[model samples]
Target chain A: MNRFKNNLTPYFFIMPAVILLSIFSFLPIIVSLGISFTDMNLRGLANWSTINFIGFDNFVQLFQDKVFLKSMGNTFIYVIIGVPMAVISSFVIAYLLKLVSDWMSTTFRVIYYIPSVTNIVAIAVVWSFLYNQEYGLFNYLLSLVNLDAIPWLEDPFIAKLSLIAMAVWKSNGVSMLIFLAALQSIPKMYYEAADIDGANRWQKLFKITLPSMSFATFFVVVTTLIGWLQFFEEPFVMTNGGPLNGTNSLALFIYQEGFQYSEFGYGAAASFVLFIIIILATLLQFKLRKSEDK
Target chain B: MDLKNNFERAIVNTVLFIGGLLVSLPFVWMILSSLKNEREVLSIPPTLFPNAPTFEHYINLFTNLNFDVYLVNTLIIVFFSMVGLLLNTMAGYGFGKFQFKGKEIWFAVVLLTMMIPGQVTMIPTYLILNEAGLTNSMTGIILPGLIAAFNIFLIRQFMVTIPDDLIEAARLDGAGELYIFFKLIIPLAKPILAVQVILTFIGSWNSFLWPLIIANEERLYTLSVGLALLQDQNVSNYGLQMAGSTFMVVPVLIIFIIFQKHIVEGFNVSGIK
Candidate 1:
């Protein structure tokens, strides 16, 4: 009887979360999968009978759609460009920070993290000010050196770059903190041994520092890749996917299609595609991590 | 951690601080520019200092925009969602140490949900809420976030380390599970609870997409939604928007200041912020 009670004890503890997840998390995924295989819209949302099964029509249409393709390309560009830029910049910043006193390091960490925690909407608002074509800070800074005001948001390429720049700045703190902790953990003996060999600064960095942080590097890179791929909040706020559909990300496209356009089927299909990409990337990362572990 | 020479050290420090300055410039600009008039904000070469600094824009948000309503609505959603924190801890404690049928499978469900980027679940979640007649209701916004899989995992991480002997002792004293949970486990889990509260509050307070969808009525608007509405109404009004965003940014700043250590520690463990 006592053994029976213990078996049931875990059930009581796990029941609430499991039930909620079944409702909110598991049920939604199943429902979304169902929706993806059908032509569901606002009309269907009102009258369930209007929904009709359309096998792969949404997926087929998504692949052919120019805006969808552009958004997909844009998301790839962000992840590809963003991952390296964020990781390297943060690593460099943290390495420089290692040269400072403990208090100084802590102060800078606090300063850097402010943006990471700030609402993306709030920062995006500030970004509009900085990106403003007429009298924005970027143009103002350019004028100081007699350079013409480059259209930060108007030009597609520059617009995407500006978004990437914001993402790198916003996220670098996480990598910085992670890298800082990893940096501090490197055995003092390794550096002391390097000193005996008269290793120069660059030599020390290349030999001891970079090599030592392989796992931390992997963590930052993989996570950043996943994050940039789902990039939505920036474009949704700053550009609304753009002056000419340049900044559109897959997530934004999914949101616009689902909520704004009420193309529930299309949005679900697009999200599933995005889901597959993320899973593949995550799995690939795991495989790489495993190889590194061995 | 060794400094090579004065020159090299000086150069690295300067470059690092300059990068920091670049990162911080937009925020500094936001505050400085918030005080300026329309023309001053849109000037060709932006003024470092506002020629005539005014709180007029902020005044506009409170008076014309009914910023107070949004503030109260935001607070309500955040406070209600604290239930999620309690639920997460309870569920986490169970997963942490309890042995039961299908525990691994149940835990996998929690972890798997974390990997699913929110878009996949969003449409159906909305449909589910709509079916319940919760659409356009504040409860629609609060219900979806009442428990998060990531928060469950975080709590589990904290609870697993808690020696089983402590709870086992209570059980020996004829204490019920409720008594052990409320009287002992809760106090023990205060640090992780604080971490969860800060994270959940910040997340809920600043949440845009869900709130945007649910709060169709102007009266139900949260700060992020309100800021977006403010932008839509006056597209060219920089000062008004900046001053308005300060409403969202400042509370978070206050939280960050007080909970700096926990927030950073939380990020380190979670690999997210």
Candidate 2:
């Protein structure tokens, strides 16, 4: 009897979370998968709306949509630029801080991490000001050196760049902290040995620091890629994917289709496509990491 | 070598000092502009000082925006979700430590859902809520969020560290599951709970996308959603927007200042960074 009760206990404990997940997470996906098969739009209901089974039509239409294509391109561009910039900058900052006094390193780490913890909306507000067209801090700084006021948000090209730059600022702190942990884990003896070999600072960094953090680097790269793929909030908050949908990410597109336009069926289809892309990207990352390790 | 290294250190220090200032420039500007009057704020070559800083905007948010409604709404949703999280933690402990049929399979299924991006299922979620007529209700706002698989995983990982013998001893004492969960398990799991609370609070606080979708009524809007609405209405009103932004930023800052150690410790536990 005791053994039976023990066997049942785990299920009993997990029951609440499992039930909630089944309702919110699992049920929604199943419903979405079902909804993807039909032309369920704002004019329709689930059971009542003569929902025709339009196999691959939605996905096909998704490819033909220029806005969807733009979203895909912008999302990739954001991910490609934002992830690497954030990872590289954070790692470099973390690596350099290691050379500073211990107290200073700790202080800088926390300070650098402040932006990471703050909300994205708040970050967007501050950065939008800095990226302001007139009397903006960034343009003012550029002006001091006789540079033209770059239309940071006004131009599509510069708008994407502005969003990406803000993304790096907002994201770098967390990656930096992760890199700091990876840095701390490296044995001092490896560096001491490099010193004996007359390895200079650059050599030591390239040889010892970078190589030792391979796992963490891989981890950061994967997660960062995943994050940047879903680049919604920054652009959504900062630019509203303006000044001509230049910064409109697929995530934002998904948001716009569903919320702004109320194209639920089409939005679900786009989102599923995005999910597939993310899955493929994650798989590729893992494959690459495995090959490098080998 | 030492002197030359010191000289290099001096150069690095100068660069980093500037870098730090550049990094924190927005925050500094945020604080400054929030205090400034309209002219001082938008002035060409903006003044560093606000001259006559006022709490008018903060006062304005409280009066006009009904920022307190959003605050209360946020608190209510976050509080219930925290209760749900407590239940989640208990379940996680049970799963991690207790023996059950299909335990690994169930755990795998739970973990699998985490990988499925929340964005993908968002439309269906809105549909579900709409069908159920829970839209514009606090229950709708907090109910879906309460289904946190990540928290379950986090708490499960934490529960594994608790010695099994203590639980066995409690079982021997004829204590029921609820008693063990409340008296023994919860007391032992405070550190992990602390981490979960801070993370969930921040997550719930900064939650924008979901709340914006479900909570159609302004009265039900959380601060993040409210801030977004404020920005949409007053796109060019940088001063008022900044004020609203400052209002949102300040509470989180206050929470961080008071519980920074716990916040960092929570991040460590959650493996967020």
Candidate 3:
């Protein structure tokens, strides 16, 4: 009896999390996958008998969905532009931060980090004011420079960029902190040795800094890529994928379809597509890193 | 060499200062605009400082907008965070210390779940909640986010570093497992617990999408959702929006200021590990 009780002890400790995850996380993934193959709409949700297993029809329709395709393209544009901007800019800021005094660095770190901690809705609200075409800060500044007032979130193309800009600002702090941590972890001896060899700052940066921080860079890139792929909140709050589905993201598309339109099966299909893309992107990054190692 | 170094330092400081101002400009503007009257906010040649700052919008938020209710609703996130922390810590301690059957496999499953984005599971989760009559309720919003896989992984990583000898010694004294966990493990895991607390607090506080979806009723809406709705309803009322934004942001900013050290250190630990 004692041995049996001891054997079950670990299970007792872990059971709560296991149960929660199984219901909320694991089961949902499987169910969502199953739902993707069925014509599960609001009626189907209401009456189980109304649902039909439609096979690949939902996936087939998703491919030809213009809005879905537009969202996919917008997500790609976001990742393509936003990822590099986030990674590179944060890296540069982190490097620059390392040059400053300890107090200054800490102060600036907290300042930059303020946006990340604040609620996205609040950030969106503020940015909307800033992006307001009339009596807005951005346009007002442009006018001061004798340039024409450009629509920040009004034009479809510019709306996408505007969302990306806010996202980059909101996110840059976290990656910047990560990079700073990475930079701090590098051995001081490497730099000393480089200085002994009469290496310039650029030479040392290329030879010592970049190579040493490769893993950190990879981690940042992969995480940022995954995050940008699921870009939702900015567009949801700011544009609602506005000005002709310009800022629409795959995640937002899933939300609008599943919750708003009750197109459960279609949304699930789009979600799986995104899931596959994220897995592939992550795997490709890992593969590239491995090849680089060789 | 000293002069050159000082010159470089001056330039770096200047650039960072400018960057800092630019980064914080929105926040400053949010607060400033919240204090401005409706007309003043939309005035041409936007004023940096309100000529006669008023608390009318802030007052409006509390009185007309049900912000007091929203604030109470937002505080319920604390309950979710606390419950999640307790559950994740228990699981973490189990995974870290125990040599149970299929432990490795179960731990692997937890890590694998981390890779699956929340959106993929969102639809089915909502359906399940709706079926259970949990939708349009605070319970619905709380249930889905109760156990983050990453938190379990983080706690487990921290717990594994705890010495096994201590546990063995406590067991030799005939201390029960639950007692040992409550008495010994909880106190010792303070640092990781602190990290988890701040992370979950900020995460739950700022969470928008799930709450927005689950809470359709105004009374149940979290601050994030309420503020979003307010923004939509009052599209051109920049003052009201800013006031609402300020109310939503101030608690987080205060928490960040107080816990800045732990917040930064926590991110460093999570990012590097």
TM-score of chain A of each: 0.94, 0.94, 0.98
- TM-scores of the models, in the order given: 0.95, 0.95, 0.98
Cα displacement (angstroms), candidate 1, residue B171, comes to: 1.8
Q: lDDT per residue, candidate 2, B19-64, as tens digits?
A: 7887888888888888877677788877887889887777878898
Task: Rank the candidate models, highest TM-score first.
Answer: 3, 1, 2
Of the pair 1 and 2, which is ahead by lDDT?
A: 1
Q: Report every candidate's CA lDDT.
A: 0.87, 0.82, 0.89
**Over the stretch A39-76, how does candidate 1's per-residue lDDT look in tens digits?**
99999999999999999999999999999999999999
RMSD (Cα, Å) of candidate 3? 1.6
Which pairs clash in model 2? Answer: none
Whole-structure CA lDDT of model 1? 0.87
Candidate 1 CAPRI assessment class: medium
Q: Show where candidate 3 strays beyond 4 Å.
A: B1-4, B266-273
**How would you encode candidate 2's per-residue C-alpha lDDT over A42-134 as one tens digit per residue?**
777546456677888989999999999998999989987888899889887887776678777766766677777677887788788888889
Residue-pair clashes per candidate: 0, 0, 0
Q: In terms of DockQ, which candidate is strongest? A: 3
Error at A193, model 1, angstroms: 1.4
